[model samples]
Structures are given as C-alpha cells and as structure tokens.
Target: MSYPRRRIIQTGGALAGATLAGCISVSDDSSDKNTSDDGSGDGKTAAGTAQLWHGRSKGPKKNLVTNVETFGSETNHSVKLSEISELEKKLENAIPAGKGPHLFQWAHDWIGEYQPAGLLSDQKENLSVDIDSTFTKAAAEAVQFNGEVLGLPWAAETVGLVYNKELVDKPPEMVEEMQSIMDEHHDPSNGKYGLSFPIDPYFISGYAQAFGGFYYDEGNDKLGLTNEKTLKGFRFVRDELAKYIPKDHAYDPQAAVFNEGNAPFAINGPWFLGSVRDSGVDVGVAPLPKPKGGTPKPYTTVKIWYFSKKMNQGGKNATAGRKFAEWHTTNTDILSTLAEEHGFIPVHKDLAGSDELPAATKAYSKSVKMGEPIPTHKHMSSVWDPLKSAFKKVVKGDQDAKPAFKQAEKTIKSNWQ
Candidate 1:
C-alpha cells in the first residue's frame, strides 16, 4: 500500500451506525443546568455540559461511552453520552423540535439532509483547528456540503477484496484475472465457489463503478442507473461473475464458504475481519481489481462527529462539545485503539499512514481511500431499493441488466416525485 508524503493532523471521533439531527445545547435546554461562566465574561467559551447521542451498539458502543467518560474526567466537563435505539429516526424527529444532542455521532451522508435543513452547524467558523488537510480526501469530501464543512470526519468504511492466502498467493490486478481465478475453482455441485460475493447493490457497486457507472452523481444531482457503461458492468456481474458465486446470494452462505476456506476471494468490508480471523484463515486484504475500462470504486461511508446547529447557541455545551470533538479526532492513541480493536479505518492523514497500523488495516485502507463517498443528496436514499431490486432481477436471470436498470431509473424518479 502507498501513502501520501505530507501528513496532516486534526482531532475527531469514530465509528458506528446512525444519523444525527437537531440538538439542545446548554443555552437552549433549561433542564440541564450545568452551564457556568469562568468569571471572566470576555466572551470566551465556557465550561459546561455536552450532550451527545449515538446509535452505536456492541463493543464499539462501549468504547464510545468510555471515551466520553474519559473526556469528562480530564476536562472537568459534564458529558452525557446516550446510546439511543432507532437513533437515526429519533434524530429526524428530535432535531426539528430542538430536542437533539449538542453533538451527535453518525455517518457523513446525512450532511446533505441536515445541513440544508438548517439543522447542522457549519463547523467552518466554530472548529478550533484547521482540517483542510487533516483527513483522507474521500473522508474530507464526505462531510462537506455546498462548500461548507458540516462535521469532522473520524473514520471511513468501504468494501474490498479479502482473500485466503492458502488459496491464492497474490490478489488479482484486473477483472480478467479475477474471472480466471473464478473459472479455475468454481464447482457449484461440489459446494465450492470461486468467490464469496454478496449480491446486494452496495457490494455490487464496484462492478458498475469500475465501468464508470454510478447510482447517483451528487455534483450533478443526477441518477445514472440506465447509463450504458453501468449497464455493461451489471451485465458483467450477472453473466460472468454470478456463475462463479454461490447460488444463494445471501451474506451468510457466501461468508460461510469463504470462512470455511472453501472460497479464495470475498468482497466485503472491515466488519468481516474478525470472522475470517476466527476461522483461522491467513487472510489478506486488497482493493477490488480494475475492470477493462476503470478501477473499482466502492461506495464509502465516513463516520463523523456532527456539531448540531443548536451548538451554535454557544455556551458550556458548545464549548465542551468542541473540546471533546477536537480531542477525540486528533488523538492518535484513541484512533489507533479503534482501528485495531474495532477495525475502523482512521481518516486522520497521519494515522492512516502510520506504521503502527496492522498489515490488514493498512492494506484495506487502500480500498477505502480509493472509494467514492456515497452520494449525500437526499435523493440518494431513494436510489438504494430500486437499484437493489434491479440487481436481484439481473442476478436471478429474470431480467436483462439494461432493462432492469431502465426500470430502476423509472422507479427512482417516481419515488422522487
């Protein structure tokens, strides 16, 4: 894996699954009376309570809470970290009613919806440190909307090729190479597969992306389901790759084959690291191979700490939130822990290239860096199901790729209306 020479540093926090909405800063919420001025009322940021809401569960959730506790202990600030279920939906409701957290953690894709709705604080003015060069280019792009920085990127998640070293000595460099590997090992009757591939649109995106096709183009705010190149790519997956993949398109069956060491390659995300390790396979991570036309570009999601517009009300809550956000993002030690323990790909420029990172992490980070940030346009939410349905139809041989994509485009437009 290669890295950029000039390293940049910034502070932020990391991972989980959620969307953030509005917030109630100390100044805005009367019930949490932890606000206090430092006696010198010179307009300096005050020390007070910072309430954060997240939807992280499991081990990563515990780590987030523990990190918040550490922030409270060191700063003499009150940090209320609540792990709420259905947090993304609750945020959609809470933010407009002025009932969200001062700071919330979630994926960066929501920047388009929240920022445009005036629910998010434009961190350009409030951020304590410059982050222009802090994170990877893709990570930085994920948090920006209409030229404004909406949040600080903590980490990035994207899918890549995971292979068992015993089956393949080296990763494929091109789609042709991958196809040849598939042809050599594929035997459906024998319960063997060449590749363990999930049939979901998210996983199959690399095929379309490799052929210069995209589900949505954020810059143009246009959908591309029917694009000729994209259709060609989908056809490739259906006609060429699908035959080598397991008949059952579900994740578990595919993963089982790869985990049991029956399959050589699997296109998956960082989440698969533990299971592969537990299966005792000497796994190696690599970027998905290039198609004839272009390199594979998987969709990426950047996890970020968003400062809600309520934070703009400014007081102890905003101040403390900023302090903690900056500290958490920039602290290499904390990021390293998350990277090693949770399999998060740190977005920090320095940490991303650090020698301290595990070999698999370093290799996987290449794919994340190469990935395109998932479109943040509100319309993007409408694209997933239609594309997914189309993919299922193509893979199942019920429809051709071109017509399937054409129908998907129509359905998405109908949804948009």
Candidate 2:
C-alpha cells in the first residue's frame, strides 16, 4: 500500500506495544479519516493545535521557530510556539497547574526531574520508529527513563580535549603525557599554565567517570562522590594537574587563555569551536586522554523534543505534537542543517558518519561517542553544587579529596529529595 507522505514517520518500523498508560495513540492505517491535521481538537475532538515551548531565541538555533512554522503550514495544523528564557522553572510551575504546552524542547538531563513529577509522557508504546537504529546509542539512551522512552533526540553535545596546534604538536593519548606537557609549560609566576581546565563538576566529571565513579546513580538513587575511585580522580587533578591550571576557572577567561595561545590544551565543548576559529588558532580536537585508572568518559547532553503529559491525553494536539516531533527529529534535511549550520553534532546514525559534516563536528563526534549521558534522575539536581564545592576545596589545596568528597556525598544524600 502507498503510504501517506506525512505518515513516513511510522515507516521506521512497527510500533512497540506495552500495557502502559500515558502513551499517545497511533492508528495502523495512513487514512486521514480519523486523523485531523488542523490542531484544533479539544479532548473530544479529532485534532487540536500543538503548543511547544523552547529556549532558543538567538543564534543559528533560532531557526527552530522557522521550522515549526513550516511544519504548521505543511501539515495544515495550528501550532503555538513560545520562546521562554527560564524554561525549567517555567515548566515546573506551568505543568503542575495544567497550563503547560503539548511539547517542550530541552536537554535529556531534565527527563529525571520532569518524568517523576508526572509532567512527561511515556513515548515508546506508539513511537513507531526504532530509536536504536534512528539515533546514536548515547542519544537514544538519553531519552529513556526507568525503561520508558520519553522524548525524541535531535542533537548531541559533549566536552573534549581542544588543543592549539600552534602550541602543541599533538593531543596527549594518556594522562601521564598530558601531565608532562603541563609540567614543561607551566610557569605560574609569569602567568602561564599548561592547560586551562575548569574545576567545575561538568568539566571534571569525565575524570571521575574514567576512574569508575559517578556523582550519582539515577538508577539506584545512590551517591558515589566519596567512592575510592572518585577520590582517585579528585586527587589526581589536585595533585598532578590543578597547579598548572590558571587561577580563573570561569568559562570566558579559560577560553581566553586557550585562544590567546597561552595554553596548549583546553577541555571544552563544540560551542567553543567558533571562538577558536575567530581567534585564528589552528584547533585540534581529541577525546580526553585515558587516565591511569581508565578511559575518560565525559558527560554528554542530548537535546530533545519531549512530549508533555498534556499531549499524552490523546487527541488532535497529541497526534500533531507526535507527528511534528518525529518528523523534525528524523528528517535528515533538518538534522543536517542543524549540524552543518549550527555546529551541533547530529545524533542521527545516518548523518553522523556522513563525510559532509564539518571537520570539527567529525572530530567531536569521536569524543561524543566516548562519553556517557548525564544522569537524568531528579535527585541529580542536588548533586551538582555539593560536588562543585568539594572540587573547589580539593583544587584550592584547602582539603584533601577524601574529606572533601566525603562531605560532598553527605550533603548530597541529605539534600536529595
């Protein structure tokens, strides 16, 4: 049978069924008889407008709004789109009051927080598309919570070792080599350092991960801050690397140190690629060197389009929202534009290996593959600050890794709600 052009999303394969509530309903046939394209359906109507909220107001990402408009025009649906600044806070407040949109765009890290609050919808039952084959494994895994797929992955990002080729011949393959380079170049008295790594948890989590530790395990709601493996990472950074890091750990200054050719290596994300190019640095990107303990695995964040509980109620809006999300995420053209124009790493398996991707993207993709998804457990929110505090103390030489991480784990457990 010929398929309706709009129903190509279901062509990814057969839909998986489960005895689960909160999943959107999908019909087997491509007939428009039961489906309404105009998003005007109330609870009882065939279709209603699909409302979406996001945080992209500027930069190349703003093109998402244009895409939404195009989707509306093409599908004959009424779409409501809003650009909100404080998306997480607004979503937390609006969803509970029953005033949230049908869909929201955000990173997969929030799945833990929203899914537990009963704000997100289980999407796998009628997803139709095979997530494992459509997106990168990491991206596909990021959208899952407690075995339920909750969103569609669109883009991927993670930190990597960014080096100035002018200053360094090649990126280090092991932490010992990296340390030697730092020692040879470091001259703290004259305001120079070997590297410009930030001490914050986001940047340092890789080291801990390399050593077989995590700040928190969302699956078991367990904290790993004080684990022996984690302490090894903290101690390694403090004793062997932190002294070579510049005093200013803020992003701008750390970037400046690298851009100005004062540092040979910097740990940063794809967002820093443009600035590096603008600064005329011959940039080289590589996966972080394997630490003595294990391979470095940074935290990766996947940008996702999540179906809200509001959309899961099943109606025109739900159908419209699911259709738009599946189409936007799976459309090779849209994903290609996101990667080519915006420097975003495409999570789609088809585009990721394409030779057409920018060189920087190709390099970063290696690092992204080596990384792990940031935990999506709601309690993860309580882990960041405490870990940062412990990290700061360790880096500043005020406290040893054991006590600092001990305190951090204690605080995290106490604050976990």
Task: Please write out the lDDT profile of model 1 over residues 140-176, one tens digit for every residue.
Answer: 7777888887778888877788889998989998878
| TM-score on alpha carbons, each prediction | 0.81, 0.77
Candidate 1: which stretches are off by over 4 Å? 1-49, 57-59, 136-138, 179-192, 251-253, 256-262, 278-281, 310-313, 354-356
- Which candidate gets the maximum lDDT versus the true structure? 1
Give the lowest summed-lDDT range of ten residues in model 2: 3-12
Candidate 2 residue-wise lDDT, 1-417, digit = tens: 111011101001111221112212232222322455343455433444677776552333346767876776666454567655546666777777666777888777777767777888897987778999899887888888878888899988777888888777888899899888878778878777798876778777777677787777767888888888878877777776677788877666777788788888888876566667667888887778887758777877888899887766665667777878888988888888767654679989999778999766776777777877777666777778888888888888888888988888888778753
| lDDT of all predictions | 0.75, 0.72
Q: Which stretches of candidate 2 lie above 4 Å from their native place?
A: 1-50, 56-66, 69-81, 123-128, 146-148, 179-193, 218-221, 259-262, 278-282, 313-320, 341-343, 353-357
Q: TM-score winner among the candidates?
A: 1
